[model samples]
Target chain A: MEEQVLIAGFGGQGVLSLGKILCFAGMKKDYNVSWLPSYGPEVRGGTANCQVIVSDQEIASPMFEASTAMLIFNEPSLHKFEEWARPGSAILLNASLIASPLTRQDVRAYYVPASELAEQAGSLQCLNIVMLGAYVAACHTVDEETVQAVLTETFGAKGEAVLQMNLRALDLGKTYIQTQK
Target chain B: MAKILMKGAEAIAEAAIEAGCQAYFGYPITPQNEVPEYFAKRMPKLGRTFLQAESELASINMVYGAASAGVRVMTSSSSPGIALMQEGISYLAASRLPCVIANFMRGGPGLGGIQPSQADYFQATRGGGNGDYYLVVYAPATLQEMCDLTKEAFDVAEQYRLPVMILADGTLGQMMEPVELGNYVPRTKADMTWAATGFQGGKPRSIINSLYIQPEELEERCLAMFDTYREIQAHEIRVEEFHVEGAQLIVGAYGTMARIVKSVIMQLDQAGGPKVGLVRPITLWPFPQEAFAKAAAQESVQAVLSVEMSMGQMVEDIRLAVNGRKPVSFFGRTGGMIPTAKEVREQILALCNGGKE
Candidate 1:
């Protein structure tokens, strides 16, 4: 299956990192993957975005005009990308920062207080990880087990305690979706 | 070796190292600064020479110096920076110094923008500097191809004693992809007779200079260089064809635009659109004129579309290659704007429907 995802937020919000991790996770599973960022002139606190494609076959174009999934972390990201969503696509909305509700009826929308949930579970810096967990739980783009393994491998060098906290943040996000279900 | 995920810039840097390029000199430019950043940290560890020159001119000249000393040396830049290096590039070409030069092209006639563009097609394939010179230009469609071609570039330059250029755009330089870096057979440059490595009681002496004031002597030198160019054209033309068997419409694209055009072709194929195909020129300089001629002369081909990221630069070569065998058209997006696959497919569909776009 080919999965094209767009993740967008403020520059310091770890949006690019979220996309990078997903790319690494997809690659670890031997899938063809590409991560393309919207760079140049973007600064801290400015809008940051990236497109990640994971496919079983060769990925022809990494730049996606429309995406199968989107993670909207702020209002500007939602306003910018909501109309570009393909039909039946999933949009994971971070309710903590975005006050307005998603009005798109064609695509599925999952609302999670990502920053609040991450703060409660560990730290607000893990906000992206929380949303990533919720998105993975909602749609099985990549296996949650594989994501966990990737996270462990990625964060292992920091320290055991830091890794556990981030893992807990991801689990909290997954549990948040399960409770809603 | 297992495949590792790497950005195109880093991959190019590592690939050069793998190819035994012992010297790198460059000045930083946006969308490709990572190349120098990578080499600065890695080259020291590898016991190679890495210098961040004060200017692009200085950087290219430094490469000239190292390459004249018979070491595999390279330099990279974006469009404006590359413009500054044109004098040095011409000198290297005239002096028959083998070196690799990479241009991660951004939008330009002059610092147009820091995004991707193929506007430099004319500058790359044609000589950016004055006089008649040709750099064997390789346009990679994917990051893996970029790495592979970069490794092969060193050998091609050495074998031909000519400058080889990896003419990539900002998109390919910035994107990340999984790359399988296989082992490269190391090339030793110890016994190069033409190299200016000091007359160590060997032969007599070697001189590397591009200035021959005598008109007749300069004409002879240029004719000799043209001989090398002719040999390269005869032997080293590379193109990748897709679905060209009975295609009515043939799309000729290169670099990032080729990848996007391929996507459009795939969609058209799936939706039972016209019999379309693509002819991707992997080597832009040795323009693959013969392949274009064959495809355009096919009984089924009615039109040839040349898509680029410029206001139609490479289309001229396409027209020449087609030689009026079929109608050649141009499609492009300039000033750092990338055309979508859907838009290209729509254009193709319009053409299929006999509507001019």
Candidate 2:
């Protein structure tokens, strides 16, 4: 289906990690995937972004302007991606920071307070996991179970403290969207 | 064969692993640092020597040390670092030591930027190191080809007793893709009969250096080396074509830029795909002349579009290949900005109809 996802935000906000997580998960699900990141003078404490392509066939080009989905973590991200999104694409926004309302009615828009939910769930860096959760829920490209397994494989060996908080983050994120959030 | 997703740098390292290379030497540089880092982790496990030298010069010298010992060895770097190693490469060439080097080139003239570029074309093909020498150059677009050709590079280096290189750009070094590692071909130090490991049996100490005071003898050596290069040009040319049959425009690009141009081909296809064609040169040196020249003369092809990262490095080669029967046009984006297929197709359409897309 030629699916493309772009995750963008401030450098410290974990946008690159989110893109990597999504790409890694999609790859494990038997899809052709590529993850490209922008890091340098342009992203020096400023805006950092990554483009992830997950396709059912060989991805022809890694660079695509109008992607099918975007997980925006901050204000700059929304400004960057909002213009380029296609007609029926999905825009997932982190409402805690992006105070503006999504004015476009052509695409499906969801505002999830990712940072607030992560903080409420007792971890700050879990914002990326929460966004991943909302993305999985919105896209359904990879099952939640496979994501948890791959997440462990990618991040589990670090330590018990990280393992514990990330697990909680994942669980809270999945449940929040499925129920109240 | 085991299929694993790897970055171009990592894939080159894995390819070295499968080839059973004796030692890998390198210093960290952007775009190609991952190759050395990857080798550091894996070489120890395989019992091969991996040295992170103090500088590119030291790394190339270390390659000299290992190659003189007649065990497969290699060093990798980007343009600036490769420039630092030029003297070492010249020494290796003069002494006739066989090894492979990887040049994952970034933008340059000085410390330009960390963007992919083909600016190193003249340096690579023209033997930037010294007098009358050519390192059989291999350029890879796909991660699989990087791995596959690394093995071939080692073989060719040893078989002809000269250096080999896999010339890539920042995109080829940093980008990740699926790659299949080929069957392991184990190499051991015992395989080299003429290696200088402190002369067992005391059969006259072998000296390896590039110094030749005798002018006539030096001329003979130069002729001998050229003979080897001629054989390489005759037998080692490799290239690929895309939708080239019966097309009005021919686009020539290499490495990562070629991959991007393919997308432009598909985009053109979607817009009723341009009656345009592409020639992707897998080898920048031993320049693939036959295929390009044969295609140029066909009445089907009206003009040749030379698309490259730099202003006009490959364009010169295209002009040389066509021999000026048809006008070869250039469309390039430099300092690491990749050209989109749409952008290139627009150029092709412009020349095709006497107007721009």
The prediction achieving the highest TM-score against the true structure is 1
Estimate, for each residue in B1-357, the C-alpha lDDT of model 2 and write its tens digit.
535667788888888877878799999998788999999999999888998999999999999999998888989999999999999998998888899999988888788888788888888888888798988888887777788888888888877788898998887787677677776453332345556778677766877878999999999999999998899899899999888888888889888778777777777777885577789888888899877898788898889988888878888988999999888989888777777756776787798886654
TM-score of each: 0.98, 0.92
| Candidate 1 lDDT for residue B355 | 75
- Cα lDDT over the full model 1: 0.91
In lDDT terms, how accurate is model 2? 0.83
- lDDT of model 2, residue A18: 77
Off by over 4 Å in 2: A41-46, A102-105, A156-168, A171-181, B182-191, B202-205
Point out the worst 10-residue segment of candidate 2 chain A by lDDT.
A36-45
Once fitted onto the true fold, the runs of candidate 1 whose alpha carbons sit more than 4 angstroms away are: B185-191
Residue range B1-357, candidate 1, lDDT tens digits = 988889999999999999988999999999899999999999999999899999999999998999888999999999999999999999999999989999998988777899999998898899999888999999999999999899989998988898999999999889999898976764454346888888677766779999999999999999999998999999999999999889999999999999999888887788887999899999999999999999989998889999999999989999999999898988899989998887788778777667754
